[model samples]
Target: MTAHLSRRTLLGIAGAGAGAYLLSACGSDEPSTPDGPQTINWWHIQNTEPMLPVWAAIAKEYETAHPNVKVVIQPLENEAFKAKLTTATQAGSPPDLFQSWGGGVLKQQVDAGLVKDITADVQPWIGSLLPASVQPFTIDGKIYGVPFDVGMVGFWYNKDLFVKAGVTATPTTWAELLTTVSTIKGKGIVPMALAGKEKWPGHFYWAYLAMRIGGLGALQQAAKDNNFDTPDFIAAGQRLKELVDLQPFQKGFLGAEYGSPDGQAATMGNGGAALELMGQWAPSVQASSSTSKKGLGDKLGYFAFPAVDGGKGTVAEAFGGGNGFVVGKDAPASTTDFLKVLLDAANQRKSAATGAVLPTVKDAADAIKDPNSKVVAASLASATGFQLFLDQAYPPAVGQQVNDSVAELIAGSKTPEQIVKDITKVAKSQ
Candidate 1:
């Protein structure tokens, strides 16, 4: 996902009357010497150890070529980056450029008039980029950001556990999936590894259920308008409750912490969970484990979440899309040039080769050698429309409430109906 700079600061950048200039002069330590190396602060939320070497090499190359421009890469944890960015921007300490996802998140920034409109720079290249890959960032007949990595939510399953449970095939329908979960549980394996500690991951159930019951458009509209009281929204919650009844997810997962390496390792490695519904970005467990690479590579099977038993949508529909870079409004001429250079075919291809992302540019996608990376690229190409991440698409207050509702639902403290009611309450209030 894209790193968050303070939305608060960006609003000031957009138009703060005379206050912004005053603050910049009196308090801000602007990037030194515009006539010298234009040091652009680049914030990102892609913070895995594996990508460090790749990013370091790229930074070195970028600096070597443009000695007049310096890119300072600041890696921040996803949520932290968002919060910090919002705070900093409000405080008038916004970076020249930063990263952010498309959809509601981008809309919020764009609506605030914080992000720069780069439509002129992007027009010539639009013909060469995949339409689906570019859709999220294109708003109001103008492009405000450059497309980068895009991902999706799908089930990741353990083949060994499935075989041990005597399951011969992956489930495609709701009934079949339920039956498979039951069978897996009967064989002493956790049917799924749904982590509640990570609120974003938990939002998947709500969004996918909403998609299944009322179609993606309806779900998105409800979220966009905060109409959780609608019948469709309630029915979606009911569907989630049905899935919960199967006891598919690992026990006590509701209280698990986000990015808990220990918990993920336990769930997928030591624990007997046979499957997990997560993003394509969840790198292979082998990347984390010192164990044998067997049962890790392509063995990690993925499939879209099935539609509800008699729902409005097909199983092919999905919730997916991720983060990328956006230039702030009023970026220096040199900074703009640096960004243009950054997106040059050479840099994008090198970044894609790190196998940490599915590039938005065709050349970068083509240069990816990893099979999984290619799979993500292919999926992006095939999607009819990319749905934004649920929590991200919703307002922060409602998103927090939804996260609480998810944790409560999984812990059995709240029934599906109760979850629906709570979300409805929040939506109406909003």
Candidate 2:
């Protein structure tokens, strides 16, 4: 996930401690080039190792087109990237171009005048992307960033496990999902791979559950009013709690550190765990491993998060958005040119062909050769609405609080009601 900034100003101040890490990550790079050839610094959180080839291809294409411009790519882990971007922006040395999630986070930086308005620059390509991919990044009617690949977070189940448990189809309702998990558990296989130690991953359950229980209108209203104490919010927390007692998660998953290939490979390959309510990012894990779970592809079955049986919400409600580029205030004009070169139809196609991304540029989805990539593209296009990653949308303090509350729920120390109350309190305070 990426957040964009203008020049170097950030208005919504996180606590003092948060600023320290940001400062270090955004540390000034030596002025590598200035007059002869413009060099732009690009930071992103596309951490997949396989994606390295795609990035290299992009760099090569851009360099060929813009002979005088150079793009230095810096790929960081998600949290670390966010922290560094924040620190660099605060300290006045932000990168020329960076990747960011678009929504409230982008809005915050926009309000701070930390990011440039690229709407005019990208207008020619606006008609290319699926309309939904552009919606989340649009603020007050202007788009702040380009939409790259759009993805959804939901349940991915192992077909082999489902067959062993005598389940023939994916569950379409919350009740059915629960029943499926219970049946899988009875068959001696853990039914879900929930990661609690990495709180953001834990937060996804609450986010999707809240959408399922409250409906998109309700969730949006709550976000607008910062009203997490509402009954619907409590209901979401309660739903997550129910799953914890079901003990459907893999053993030690509550303590699993996310982004660790070892963790996912171990649980899915050897452990009798059947499903993971994770983002599209999970597939790369299986694909990268040498274990039996590797190369799952379509065998990695998926279903949209189900509606709470008979609830106001529909099964189509999903969490989704894209990872794309943003220019910094301090960047040279060549940086924008460089981005354009990299995002050209051919280069975008190359990225899709490599299977590391779905293009942010219009018509780029057609270049995707991998069957699973096509499936992911179709799923993204059909989504009803997308939420930027929840924690990413919340201000730091509030996001951290929401994260901790989920952890406590998993620990059995907080009820959904209490969790909602805490979140509402922080939302109001903001």
Best by lDDT: 2
lDDT of each residue in 108-170, candidate 1, tens digit only:
677787888766655555455556556567665567766566667677777888889999998
Residue 161 of model 2, lDDT score? 89
Candidate 2 similarity to native, TM-score = 0.82
The C-alpha RMSD of each candidate to the native structure, in angstroms, is 8.2, 8.0
Off by over 4 Å in 2: 1-39, 45-60, 63-84, 259-265, 287-298
Q: How accurate is candidate 1 locally (lDDT)?
A: 0.63
Q: Candidate 1, 134: how far from true, in Å? A: 3.0
Give the CA lDDT, 0 to 100, for residue 88 in model 2: 89
